[model samples]
Target chain A: MKLFKKMRGGLSCDDVMEVLQSYLDGETDTETARKVASHLDECTDCDLESSVYQNIRVSLSTNKAPIDPVVLDSLRQFGERVSRGEID
Target chain B: MTERPTEVDSPAASADATEAFNRYVIPELEVMYRTARSLTRNQTDAEDLVQDTLLRAFRAIERFDGRYPRAWLLTIMRNANINRARKKRPDLLDDPDLTFERSVDFAETTGPEELVVDPTFDASVTDAFAELSTDFRQVVELVDLNGLAYQEAADILGVPVGTVMSRLHRARKRIRDHLAEHGLDSAAALPRGATR
Candidate 1:
């Protein structure tokens, strides 16, 4: 939809995670901040969605779990690519 | 020299930047991975995406001001993921068997049951959250999950703050409507803490 497009396009899954991050941090603007608030008002889905994304990223105060070894290796290789400046 | 920061254009600078990145920034690999995982919801894709991002950051480190190093790297990751995603084909209806396979026991690593907060909802909340379009999910991820400021998210997303808020508002509202339609919450109950 054009409206969604206006929000911007090509955003990754990480971009969808901001609901709880901005709210808990208290950095979200009053009005835009209310987006989360207002979303909660009528939509339980956003409420849950916001909270779940929070769980995955922050896990509250607990240390984020270690990534899988294979995943780490991939990142390491990607990092090597970066260090090597091989990506176009 | 090429306008883009390239290894060949200035090997010394790239080398110095990579050394500094490895020492000071690469240590955040785990953190980047977690963020990437949350975004991609696929362990393999998340790792590759983060790897691609780290590589991009290393190459572009010459332009990095060493401010908000993690966020800078995240922006690179976020952008790389988007670009790579565009290169793929979307074939939702092409294969019924593949769809059936995905729907059977196909679970996001982070399920609603494992989710930390209770948020006064039930089982269907998971389905609703899953149903949201990718755009809405992006706003929730950036501002709500990772806690990047609107300006920073804007920097990564290349949108105005107003656009961010409005999209977040509408996207979230749509999700709420979805939940309500699913009969997950009551309209008359004593309203626990407001959803905000």
Candidate 2:
């Protein structure tokens, strides 16, 4: 299956893997992201990896504590004081 | 480089700096705190870091361009953390704690044979994250969680862009391997639109 998939595209799984991080991070040029996305469509392993990567990113960003209100207020006040030349 | 304002001490100049801080920098304190927490992993230390970061930033507000405040602040915070770390344990600079990665027996947990038998394992993503090496976790938190651009993350972490990409790739791979171990590798788990 992997062999057949590779035959259809210029990017084999290895090729896609090499630039997959840049593609995922949206740092890749349009041409490269397109190629990797095209390859991932037919490559189950790469597809799985792509999704797992997205899920992990979502999981990391979704679950987090809100910044403490006290902390925010204090930082704001401190900034004000610095502006006023009250604190160095 | 953006040219720094000539005088930050004049009342008008100070007021402008204050206004910029309120409009541009204050809004990003939450993210700054989040990154600080990730770096310190201790509540008190995170708070101190945030305070120190704000202090340093306000002092240098005349030089700030008000573009990409989070990245700018993170760069400062990263430096402050390094300085703090150096002060506490100067020798740690010579010897990093790389043992955390080696201490984990990946073979037993993520071995291919074990993955096959696990059937349907379930583990929290957070738990898997905790098991990652500090270096990997730092990249994950900065780039993945905080949504910093790769260059921004690299700038904040003081590594090359290529290093950021490679570390992010390996970090995500580790998390995926952990998920696979727990039997979360179902096709349904893949996000919609993963394919063209």
Could you say which candidate leads in lDDT?
2
Global lDDT for candidate 2?
0.68
- Poorly placed runs, candidate 2 (over 4 Å): A1-10, A41-45, B1-13, B92-122, B191-196
Instruction: Tell me the tens digit of each residue's lDDT in model 1 across B1-196.
Output: 1233554564444567768677646777876776666566667777777767766666677677777886677678667766666555346334321211122121253444454444434334445545656655566556655556666666556567777677666655554565567553344122333233
The model with the greatest DockQ is 2
What DockQ do you compute for every candidate structure?
Answer: 0.13, 0.37
Candidate 2, CAPRI quality class derived from DockQ? acceptable
TM-score of B chain for each model?
Answer: 0.60, 0.72
Worst 10 residues of 1 chain B by lDDT: B97-106
Clashes per candidate (backbone, < 3 Å): 23, 1
Show model 1 residue runs off by greater than 4 Å.
A1-25, A28-70, A73-88, B1-19, B34-42, B82-107, B112-124, B175-196
Go through the candidates in order and give each one's C-alpha lDDT: 0.54, 0.68
